[model samples]
Target: MRRHRSSREIAAAVFFAGLACATLGGMGQRCLPVAVVGHLCVDLAPRLREAAVLEPGRLFDVGPLGVSLGGCVANTGSRLLELGVDAHLAATVGDDDLAEVVRAAALRSFGERVTLDVEPGAGTSYSVVVEPPGQDRTFWHHSGANDAFTGGTLPPGDVVHVGYPSLLPGLLAKDGTPLLDLLRRASARGSTTSLDLAVVDEKSAAGQRDWADLFARVLPLVDVLSPSLDDLLSALRIDPGTTPRLDLADELAGRLLGWGAAVAVVSAGAEGLVVRTAGRERLERAGSALAPRAEAWAGRRFRRPVIAPRRIVSTNGAGDAATAGLLAAVAAGADPETAALVAVTVAATVIAGDRVTPTLLEDLVTPAPTTPSAPGDPAAGAAPSAPLLLPANQPRGRFYRGGAAIGAFRGTGAAEEFTPEDWVGSVTCVRGEPGIGETSLPDGVRLRDAVAADPEGWLGAAHVAAFGADTKLLVKLLDAGQRLPVHAHPHDDFAQTHCGTAHGKAEAWYILSPGEVWLGLARDLDAETLGRLVTEQDIDTLLGAMHRIPVAAGDRVYVPPGVLHAIGQGILLAEVQEPEDLSILLEWRDFELDGATDGHLDLGFPLALSAVEHSARSREQVEALLTRADDPGPGLPVAAEEYFRLDRHDVRGSAELEAGFAILVVTEGPLEIGGVPAPAGSTLLVAAAAGGLTVRGNGELLACRPPVAR
Candidate 1:
């Protein structure tokens, strides 16, 4: 029987495969180079109102003119760079003043990989992009230097991408012989040949040629062909009136495959990507980078729907971004489904005005690392051996208010608005976000990277043996300026089964200021009624339904997963929880956030509400979850001991601390730990290698650690 592979193993296999390909020719190169050869230009977009008057000689006030690089070399190449690929530009520009602008923009990311053939006595290509509010963009383009391009001097890379063939007049001069030769040369070098097309303008001279003949001649040499649906229809001179988009895409992809291409990827705007591949024999010939996974890639067809962003900016480069993602994943040996998913994900980042990263792509292929450590880990030397100070890591753009308390506590002056939580010593990021909520050390290293690099050194041998590099803990200082939105988190079972995550959120709070907090259900209620109450935005009933308890400084409260709770205004606390940011908000009215859109964690209300605890908790049971900070032994209740451990050490004169991987927050201190002056409000990370440490001073210290690794 064939051995089954876990997601982690698959991710590791693909990552190593990509690593081997990255060092092509054994010259010790770290990144695989992808050559983007075609159509480079400058774009100047001036935003106008929806009803702007545009008569011949009339001038209207508009927003700033956004000047940026355009065409395939910029859109697709820059996107590839953002995905951590080394994209080399092999295009042309005229020897004019505008060439400097193109050079400046392209060199910022592509660096020396930009090989611009300066065509003397010709003007550089440019486009005036007219984008009105809530309308598709229109371009006034000048072919300029692009008309003189001959597809010569292609960058020496593993993949050669010829983009926007419809815009290159020279390539279309002789039945696309020049374009055909370019693909042949690239294929002869064992490099993967990819092609992309622009929408054909029937009135243009290049567009008036036989495009079907051109594609037929060149596609046999092409391994990957990505084209927009409309472009494909226009190039082939075919029209399908009222045909379902998926069916149309299927028909076109099949035609492309039949024409001898290894794979055809069709972009249907917001409908996402449609992918079709040839059988194993042809797939094995796709390229060295993709051949190893030919068995998985062979004869596959699927459509990946777009994962919508929180807000849509301009849909300008969404298609190119999708192509970049598809190519990068293919080079990394991802299967068709995963490649399509990465394609859509990258497009969504472009829509949301965000940049893509390799970490984001890796998350789609595997969960966080949680397997046992290997023999002789390579990253152990990079782990922290001594305690490091963590600067304030308060993320902005929260719906709630209040950061003054956190700002004062961390000794950081003048906190900005919407910055409410300080994630201290955190190795986890916000849900659906890879780099946002993680903590950074003083020297600009991300805590997550450090912990991942040396799990044994940072997390201890036993912890690494059990939990891999997963810190399994998140520490935060949340300052609630206004009453928090009623919310609940799913437990581990629901999170893993339905949410595709490793941990659910079970949190405990160490109160620093007095406030009234809502906890647990006041009475038993059915799931249907609970859903109804949430849908109606019945704030009064929702708050009244939970037991309200007063909390003071030095009080500890344990909040289990699935329990609905809210922190009252004017409360400041240090919290520890499972390393996740999964919250299902029950109410968001009167807050800056839109509850109807964002409250459900992307799982619609009906399904999300099922994760809530509907059974009532008696007053006695609720009280049992709380404990005084001055209580004997552990700081929190016994139930929380399984998730995390918080210990308060009171120092009258001096004390000795048992060293481990933990976060130390000086609660009330004008004290010193191992000769470092840890005054009130200082936070420090203690690595296990630090061993037993001597603490001297008169104050209180709270050490937060992950649950004992069993």
Candidate 2:
């Protein structure tokens, strides 16, 4: 039987296979000829330690310094070569020390494919990159010889990519006349023409020009126009202050299409790439590269979320890398969706301090074929196990408000208001909502199905022996946009006896944002009063009954079954819970949800109210439920061991972790877990087969796992 494949895998295969075709014409031994033109510079990057601070007249300690090639020709052209494409670089530099550095870097990678125009007496461009730990990099750039670079002769190639027009003042001068001329020449040669723009200083002369007018004149000849959202916004003089990023991308892409570009791609950092293409007629004129599939490429609109990198070193050349990937895919005749995926994947590898190797690209997009086990065998198709990257599974039309925080955290673009909870590696569905909260892998296989196929591989032999195929763990990224209604969940015994469920909901939260939480009752109340509170919906008195405690990032709070609690508003948290979702709503006023109908797990409020913990608890008792960020091991309370387990690791140099079936969440910094680059705000699922993982680099990670087998 054939193995199931994801659209991503198919796209990757199609892209690479198309590159291998001889119909596109080859350069030397390499297919898919691409020409990368525009800014070239030397980058001097100084890495900083966590303790290092940037202050005037104050020197701080630093890590190793790195000298590398920067700008479009260096970043994009080199990436194209790495992806097995023949990329010829056409860029200008000066006869200076920095020029030598640029030459060495370029020649070392591209060899004869590099063409450098050395301007006499002119200085080569350079950038001083001030990159701090766990922060975006700041560049102090000098556009030296780049300013002297007029439109050069087009390199002979199937696709010509001109980049960083904002940095090349020569092109931006005369209202982008030189750029238009170059694109026109490339188009006339029947070559695909692509353009990329750099971030421009608002006060610079290039930024002061009428960019809208310039693009209007130049875009007609350009086949592909890809620019960073910020740069596009700046060029169009659009203030997207509070507009959602996806919406903004749509608007920008519309304008670019209106300006006559064959395709418009907005590289929205974190949100990934937003691509919109022109009609069939316009796409037909795009160039020889896209001519084969112009019909499939026309009038398509989609957004590709940024693929989480193994780790993020620096985002310096990511945009350029993405442009290279897009151009490569276009040269190979890939459909728009496949092309976007390829672009994002390539950019991810760039950020992870690595380039996309053919093998790595295949591993990322292709699903491994597995031999089917004997009939009736549960452990059927889970072999050659590796870590699976889980995308954010935020369900929509939820009762709560807020998902924008989750979207921001996951870099998946703006989420709807009701999608406040992100279910990660989830096998359990919402109570009474089958298939609602269960997570589906990128390959379209359900986590439940994968676990079922190879229980021993996914859950370990010992775990499967003890708990069958049950994961018993449900992880979530929760954003309380508004104060949650006071509620409580039934204990296992109560659930089994009344609700007929296998397990009750015993959950814990690892705070990611600061806020207050109500847990347990401050004073004792009779069952009649608690029942009356639910019956009468007395919101004030019910909330006053519980102890309100403050929480901050890294703090862990354990909520035992039957404990009445409510998560406060303006707080974002990572939650680990039992595999069931059963809550007894005690208060639900002022919320959009019809609590009277849906809040009580369908058992009716009268029966569900019996599960509430009405006993009075002292301040000390309530405080014991919380654990500080600096708490030793296993952030959650010991009581939580019966349900799930969570361990917080503050890795500095290196740490070795025992192999297990676990979900690793990188909370801060860039680090490698089991040879995977795990950047901050990324989640990775480590299988039992990935044994003895070693964590390198500085970062904070939370390892969430199922409880030990009995």
Candidate 3:
């Protein structure tokens, strides 16, 4: 549920931040931006060998000291930007020389994107990190100005991240209200939020506090909660290295999830990490601000092995690297499995290096390893497909609470079953593939590879040549159980220039049920007004500005990028888009989101507001955009043909479907396609090579395919 800004968008935001754009300059042009709130301190590490003994009164000889900007502010924030996230930073620093060094490092790393509040005369906080070779390091830390960072004032972003509450006393005391209030504000503004923790010192003020009461009050406000094992153990006051420590960690993580965290991850050194999720319920709680896909996280319960670094240097900041990587992946629409692996891999890279640098962080942003073979391939130990039936990939999404519409298509009766089972979406996605929105094959086979192994058969030879083995389309059975937030997606140009991605979201919908919806703007509004209303959290004004439309069964709506829209509750539709799950939320109030922190995509309001189409639409414009189902014959309007296409076939007696890489959703039927016995509510992937597959039985189906150009 904790939505993260895409590394691409985050990097773009950082690009502007690094530039220190004075007035939303470059940021106004980007997508989702990320903001990190925490302590920006100096880390002075002095190395010592394990054999060295501490002398009570003697000044022992140690190696040369390594000085750099430490703490999550510099560590995580810098890495996220370096990894190409459009991100910014906010932290409190003392007005000392060390603060200047912190300032220099931050500016040099991310420019004005990082906001450092200098407390006059107060010395910057510092840490004396003592790392004895092969031994756990000890930290002698000074809270300094960091003790006062309660997120009192935060820069704008689509996702807001905070860390080291133990190091921020004012942020943690009184049941962490100040920090919690900030998080609530961020969610109200529609930002997906994340929280990180630091190891607590047994002798410090933090160690003396009652953690049990504090976490219960704060954890639920966070979408993503990642904490180190040491921190969790110390706060819970559990004996160290118990007989069943790993088991205890899992139990602890589950408790936090129960406390309200959507996704709970605990980092255990050497043993790696354990992640838990409540699936459907959690995704629903995240709301539409994040556009979270259910299958990517819901029902995901897994453990990952540590990616050992090439060698051990200092372990400091490695945890931050891990956290940054996972969030980046999540923001980029990468699956949960990929996110965890990337996190561990980045941590490994950090540990293996002498120090974290831009060059090193770049390596952390590489593509994840692809699957070896298609799922269910004989070599993979999964059963082979039975004739015309391909695996029915139905994954839940965070946008809705249940997928009754999707479930009905899959033959799951009246019970609106939703969870690991939410929406039946995607088949050979062209974009955001092998990352997020990809389908798994039989027995763990990946859809990408399955098609790659036989491109001509799966996708047409033309599609393979024009768009490679990947299908240039994505199809989904969307059930709007609730009204989606007023939002818009970026265009290809906007994405390339601001988000650094090849594709932007250009989608169309084929309504399967009746519901009210909002689209486009009723009248042109000045950019300043739009930005002001957004900043002021004027939900009524913003929603009223858009064109409201009443849609019913068989309505075909074309949703171009950069246009504001909201799918009214109770409408079920077959949705198709550019494959990437990228949305810029405009209204988050009354929804489960932090509009102030997440609505702007980290580029600030001015820049993000510019991407929206503020031009007024006439009644004709509205009518042209909406094509009644009765007027069309199995295809979308001209505005959408360039992106994707859809066709509805009501089968009865005998019918044959043309061959092409297509997804067939049984809207209403008890029929067979290409020899596959598909009943009503079943989804099947039909290969182009299947040529004109013979169909038998009476049924209705929605046939989906990529754009004509591909």
Candidate 4:
């Protein structure tokens, strides 16, 4: 009978298949796109007919109002497209007469880059600005569809700029929740955003409070916050009149940076603009034109003096134009200083025009060169550079080993030292042995044999011990007679099934002495010979088949599992192995001990025979051991994987082991760890948890640890 598949099995297969497809799909698609949001507005300005005398109840006649595009949506959006950016504008417009006009204008000007969403019954916004004379303009703004704008209208883009939130009352709702949500969505889509502060009606308490809280929530997400000096002063509640006599623009920029802007550019009227980034500020002045021949003859030629335009016609949209120029320059990859210059030039052009005349402004627009000026160039001026800080107590941009710097603070006279407290701990040892006898450590503490202590410290000390926990091989230092048997270990599967253990012994040895060793498959044994000898228990014949090589200090040899090998007498080494003890002894001849039951080896006969790699045991195929003549005795012998790395340090005279906790083993002369005396053959297990202390001693200290794996 056919049965239904279980939900668990079906889900598991589906999840793994989907994950693989997603990983492969992501590897093929990568690109960058930009999104611009905020509603578009039509600005209508009445042409000045006649100057009105200042008197009560007096009305002056004016020409018919002219309609034009306004807001950051029109300026920044159009400028980005003009600069050939892949920028898409997302905004809601009224589905009325004005909407048709606005859509037509945006489509004609922005080509396919403009995206307009029509909201029914919503009137398209239009501001009727009237400037009589010598006074700030009065705006008759009609907020139509923009009042209902929400985060749903914002499209994904590489960069999102919220032009004028003041026009949309919905943006200033409560905590400016809608605006914050839109900006957050853009950020989540990996877009860098900028928010331009709109004009606030500060006469009312509600208006002032709303703007203050709005900027607080807005500025944090903004990467480049370009606010006019006056707007910042209003938002920060700083009284410009009572502040200490200094460059207010520079001070405001500094305050904004401290408040968490990656970069801040403040436009300071006649004083030009101040650009601050990475804790350094620079002043970018307006560019001056060379004096005409007539002016030059009249001694009016100034020496590189930045001058505002000679005539002022219309100042209404000058700031917006300047912002457009700056954004355009940045989108085109201009530096902060160069972008500031371009912005000022654009502002100067606007002031020199009657209306927002694009043709005349373009004629007057002179952009700073794209190429960066060389250092010390007169045009670039001398700006203070931010100091480069280095890691702990070390000199800036310098490499260090011991007794070097740790952390460094730029502009502050503070640095930290790299010491033992900075590291986990160090390793140290005394004598040298290849595998069994020599004492070692995981980090700083001494390694003890399991049989030596009831509660073995080194056995379960590390997060993962070098050897298998169930293995029978006990690491020990032999001062007298102790020869290991010639044996091999079964594979994990075989050992688990027959020997009641889960691991097999695949071990390697690091020779720490000068001694000759016999290793590899039995001597005079081919595949057939070894197989026959293993079944017959011909211990002597098998031992004779193995190869014997002279191994010196700092030599390494690999002994794979199921390979019959043994450490010859007089050889000492450090052994790293899969922690397991099952061994199949193949040799038992000419020893002053019982050969049978009493002193016999457990072969795990059938299991070992099945798991043994006959090809790897050949004499010619066995790898020869490598030894280093010049050994840097255990301190931290480079990081390793097979458990730990061991380092050996040779110290002469009275040496300070710095102020830190370290395990000091007195292999030679007397040494002191943490000021406590440790004589020869004494193992001082220093506690790293105790913090830093002093280690003073006289002798060669061998520091051993697991080898660092690649």
Each model's lDDT: 0.78, 0.78, 0.69, 0.48
Q: For model 4, give the 10-residue run with minimal summed lDDT.
A: 285-294
Assess candidate 4 and give its TM-score to the true structure.
0.41
All candidates: TM-score: 0.48, 0.52, 0.49, 0.41
lDDT of 1 at 619: 97
Residue 400 lDDT (model 1)? 84
Number of clashes found in candidate 2: 3
**CA RMSD for every model?**
21.6, 21.8, 16.6, 24.9
**Which has the better lDDT: candidate 1, or candidate 2?**
1
Q: How much is the lDDT of residue 407 in candidate 2?
A: 59
Candidate 4, which segments miss by more than 4 Å at Cα? 1-34, 50-59, 83-86, 133-136, 203-213, 236-238, 242-246, 278-307, 310-313, 354-710
208-244 in candidate 1: lDDT tens per residue? Answer: 7887676677778898998989888887777879998
What would you estimate as the lDDT of candidate 2? Answer: 0.78
User: Model 4: how far is 53 from its true place, Å?
Assistant: 8.1
Off by over 4 Å in 2: 1-384
Q: For model 1, what is the C-alpha lDDT against the true structure?
A: 0.78
* Model 2 pairs in collision: 310-677, 310-678, 311-677
Q: What is the lDDT of residue 475 in candidate 1?
A: 89
Between prediction 3 and prediction 4, the one with superior TM-score is 3
Model 2 lDDT, residue 186, Cα: 61
Model 3: lDDT equals: 0.69
Q: Which residue ranges in model 1 land beyond 4 Å of their true spot?
A: 1-31, 51-53, 366-710
Residue 455, candidate 1: Cα error in Å is: 41
